[model samples]
Target chain A: MSEDKREMFDEQDDGKVKESRRDFLKKIGVAAAATAAVPAATAKAVSIAETLQSHFELMSDEQKQKAIARLEKRYSEQFGKQTTVANTPAPDGVLFGYALNISKCIGCRRCVEACVRENNQSRDPKIQWIRVLRMNRGNLTFDPKHLNEGKPSSDPLGNYGIQSGGHADKAVGISGEAEHYYNPEQVPEENAFYFPVQCQQCEDPACTRACPVRATYRDPNGIVVIDYNWCIGCRMCQLACPYWARRFNWSEPVLPNEDMNPKTHYLGNRPRMVGVMEKCTFCLQRVRDGRYPACVEACPVGARKFGNLLDPESEVRKVLATKQVFRFKEDFNTEPKFFYYMD
Target chain B: MAEEQMVSVGRRKGQDEVIADKRVFLKRAAAALGVVAAAGLTGTAVIQSARKVGGTNARARCAEEDVRQQQIMVGKQLLLMTEGEKQQMLDRILSSHSRKVS
Candidate 1:
């Protein structure tokens, strides 16, 4: 609206002015369209590349960065919220460990619900990482005859008296099987115990070895994880795991767009498309950030303990040192980092 | 004697579908003795086993290094406990479940 600017515009050659302005407008429109299309177009392109992408180990640093950024943007669009997807590697000199005080767990299932929410597991089919097993408190022992009769506790700690270091070890007390899959109105069942089981994150993981493609593997931080995009959903890991920790996504996970956890780890809790195997990663997204696992935060009774096993002063190292700790199936030689213990 | 006892245990199972109530109590007492004998008794062996919790050895198999480690562990666990939990832990370590009997 300045007089000099208006005069300059008016003085321009009418024919040339129309031509130049039209060309400028055309350039500006094309530039804006390309800028807008890049992310949407790139997002679509990234999805295709992601399926065909090399194993994370084989990708270069630059390729990994681009892939992670695109994934964050794409997930943000899909979930309609700000999303953060990153590949946070485990710090050196830290080997993670977890312990559960079986007697302290009240079978509240708060941890189970917390896991479902944190991991973006299916809502309708209800994929859960942690399973709290209600077992009768009686004389239980790992009798060889019982092992011959069936698999040694497909229910993991459900029949915990036999899991070692309890009154059940001597075969001296009451005799009965666990009243498993027990869903009661009120928990801390009379004369009963609760044993919550999840991925042991084995030192020598059976689930990883069972993977034909090495899709499921243990991280340097001692967490057994599945690369969801690489998984073929063969369910071999499920069969190999003594703890029965692996879960298969039968249908695309039913998490609502709004409900999905926007904070995700590349090998941890990102929302998975159907046909992949998933198990607990000890809330890798949170733990790598120096926070407790979601389930551990939710547990009201302080039953769960997690810390760096390599650190001499950490809770997990001290617990294993002073307490009687044992694996679910020691004979299987999985060498699980998870332990059931009592002080 | 160990072989005979095992054979007798097998025989008892073969003979009866249900162990008699008196037999169950007798078996528990004998098993309790076995636990005491098997603990490789150190100083705390007799008292702990006598409590019918012979499977646990309070000072069993711990070396000097393990003792240090356990001490450090106790310090760490104490930090995690609430005041109430700390009291319960104190109670457990200070005495057996004698209060439960009363």
Candidate 2:
């Protein structure tokens, strides 16, 4: 070959060699970076597994056991105690129901305190599942004549036509305006009656129906429950609930290790994370073990009663048979298992 | 003049060959990257499905009879008494209390 041609071929070969070296260096750089990230990726594997885990109801027996074990370990380490998360299914031939005698309640809020202690509710944000509302004794009335008495008078001379100083009529039964934070030195105030509200455990729950993800559902024992992990934090169930029973965790739940109840149920009063909806499970953790709910046991007056509605001899059945009972918002036809009675 | 023209043509041909080689390299690199990404995603999806437990229908099991009875009780309002009956019962209790006080 001519000398110039040989020089041209050598220059092209040099360029090719330089380009191959640059490509090799780029590959080495990527491999080193990936190697450096291995430890962090490994550390996050457990959390990743948890996030990808299936819904609790969809798990088989073995998967459920594995999931429960994982939760127990995590909770035990978190709370500094031996936490046991029970997955007790609904017992056969039993339908749970609740009854409360409005006359017997004193508006003391003992049940509210007891529920917080038992449920491991967030303390810093102060979430309570039970809300006790104070209402006047004759607040509920069917008479239509008294309705117009509360309206403002159109007359210029107020006293001669209608009273100006008098307040509006108390809402016809339980309503949003009822005093939820009344403190008058002591409870059972004169002419005032207490109405404690919690999850009604409805047979046809609108909350369950509104749940797009099917995370909350009614169990065989007539209790509504939520799968915390499966919940998408859409707040649809909270909006659907008429009783204002559901509580949402806006911030990270602050549960002191000392105050944490080590015993928990998968669907009941387990410690929940931020951005999840929680509500009363009728103390299913205790009830499924054949024990009275913490609220029922804590009440000074025996106003709260819980039992299987199927059994003829149960306390709830007896109350249903004889008492003058009424379900809240009966017009909605949600078929709540909870009944309020007058003695 | 002809030799100068030939030299210029040769340099242009060399530049074209280099550009074509770079294009082929880029195409092969892109295809390799795409294959790797597809494999990673498919593997992740397979692992997730394998880890998940099956049978969503089993969780929906509930006692139908108890639910029926509850519906019946609610429909009949068996636990509730009429306003007149409640008043009468309260009056009877008060009268009994008054008699005992006397």
Candidate 3:
């Protein structure tokens, strides 16, 4: 019996040892499998992470969601506020008109500088919005003094009788045999006038009509405007303009880091993107808000007159009706809003 | 002879119970180790991914801010006063006082 008992205990112990060994092997097997799976899972997670960090333009839809979520959380934390930015359409019903006083205008180029800053024009050294065309009144032969009455005349063209067609209605001179001494000191004389030229803002603007894609059009206020986003840089409008007012952004406008205008209107003088056509919007932003155009407001000489042409009480209308206004290239019938007048 | 009989009976009955207990203990240890390892690995992956996403988002926000800054500068610089901007630079000079036209 004793021998049998000892044998039974030995048998039980051997069985237990066998089962424990099997359990140990199984546990090790499970651990090894888990270790193998970890690396693959880690690699997958890393690749997904890399995709989320890619640029917004390159992100796929799934990645984009991840990216946007991250951005939203970050922005909220950084700004401590929530804000969404969107593009809004420009306001309507703004008309612009400008008149230059040839009689009072001196040949100073101050209007040029003021216009540059006001319009946020390209800083191209050659880009000037206002061009001072100096010519002699009597001498149509492009005499600088006859046109530039602002300065003392070395060779005043007034002596030549070039502007004097001798017609009594349009004529201003001592028409007899007496020598009319052309005085350089005296201004507002029939002998001298200076004209500054810019976009005509014509009623029948040829530029708008010539655009193939309708990228350019006359706004409700009669101001000609160009949509840069729609423009294909065909340069057709530039050729159609009689005044040579439109300019193409040959390259992206090279603006200084500090010189970009953010409050941009599509039609107004915004910092246009590359390969687009741009022209004066007649300071539409200001005009729509019941303010004078930028160029008009900058002229210290008060030479520029601006107001609604339709409003009888407006200064522009009054000046057009009473003053002896003459439109440039009237024969073409552009009916330009801009005009020149003597003091 | 009697002793041998008792030993065989005892071994037969206890063998199955001891084997079962030993197997259960070993299995429980292995399962606990696996659960802990998986949890650690997954948690680490999640943290790494979140960090990468956050960094990219910060860079994009910086670029947008740069654009806004540029626009503000241009607008302020180009703001010409209405009265001064008019084509009256010369007009003001000539009209400073009434001039006698010859």
Candidate 4:
């Protein structure tokens, strides 16, 4: 062996020395422990820092920047996909609003499936943010007779009727007056009209008021958001929302690598752990980047409209003016930003 | 008076020049570190983050797919929606919100 290579034991390199099996074993044990200790220590430190992080509102500009970088790195490793958790503040002079042309909804449920993929909502038990209620014309209640007796509401829809629509009312506490929700093979049921309901992102959010920890609150841009870490998952906000907008994460979010939307925002679709409340941020992840919400883009009929409520020329604002806009449960006086319109 | 005060114009030491002076070296190091930290916080780039996107993951490789393959997009001309769904949309337009049982 060469002079340097011969120092495998290195006993003679430092002067007269010899190797002992005990010493060698002891050294190896320490090396092994150190190797394990590094990652363990790093992980513990990260969790400690996460616990110390201030709320988005409370963070200073410098602190918020650091927080965004930290969250982006953390999510990148966890999902094995590149993620950018931007802390893009709600744009000034912009309050996002949504208006869905109910006359155009076909009850295709494309929006529901799109949301499942876009928002990282659980697939197994199925948490749907947008609930499309297939109601009989002139009635807000679900009636199964549209499909139960194998009779359609009218015309070609009745002729082609299959089965669906029993999921929305009960979840939102509309079941008392509405009994039957049938999913039917085809929709619009001739006599039926569909309107999707999600987080109204109320101008006066009852969910925000109901939050015991004040984890859920409306940001300056008029988007109601949840601070995942601060949320105790007491579910006070869930019960408080007349729209049933908030959802509890009963378990750690299981996101498939290929299905994960790499583009994420800190206040938006970045995945959550087992026991936090999540709700629609109107696709803050995408919208802040000047892109449309997943459901808005996915609608084939071009029914779902979204834009800056502050911009007079925005599509949503135009729809609000030109169409007959209606708010669900407006009697509750929550002042929901979400509007349903028929043109 | 503050604006009128004379400011000294001095030659900036090169990266190599300040090596012998501990305080100057330390101050220079701190300034450089601050710039690096700023770049990192911006997530613009500071020697390319270890957890950057387009790392060796298969999900990173999936970006090679065409834009149409993306799940979320606007005004998609080719409908992934079914024929029946499209027909219903057309029916709504033809009927003009008054699809009468009559």
Best by lDDT: 2
Give the number of the best model, judged by TM-score.
2
For candidate 2 chain B, the 10 contiguous residues with the lowest summed lDDT are: B53-62
User: What TM-score would you give candidate 4 relative to the actual structure?
Assistant: 0.59
Docking class of 2: incorrect
Local distance difference test values of all predictions, in order = 0.66, 0.71, 0.55, 0.62
Lowest lDDT 10-mer window, candidate 2 chain A? Answer: A157-166
Interface RMSD of 3: 22.3
Docking class for candidate 4: incorrect
Where is model 2 more than 4 Å wrong at Cα?
Answer: A1-46, A142-176, B1-102
Angstrom error of the Cα, residue A171, model 3: value is 21
Residue-pair clashes, model 2: 0
Sorting all predicted structures by lDDT, with the top scorer first, yields: 2, 1, 4, 3
TM-score of chain B of 2: 0.48
Candidate 3 local Cα displacement, residue A257, angstroms = 2.8
Question: Tens digits of per-residue lDDT for model 3 on B1-102?
Answer: 689668766766786677678669767866776776677667667756754663454345333432332222110111111333233422332232223337
Q: Model 2 TM-score?
A: 0.66
- The all-Cα superposition gives candidate 2 an RMSD in Å to the true structure of 13.5
Candidate closest to the true structure, highest DockQ: 2
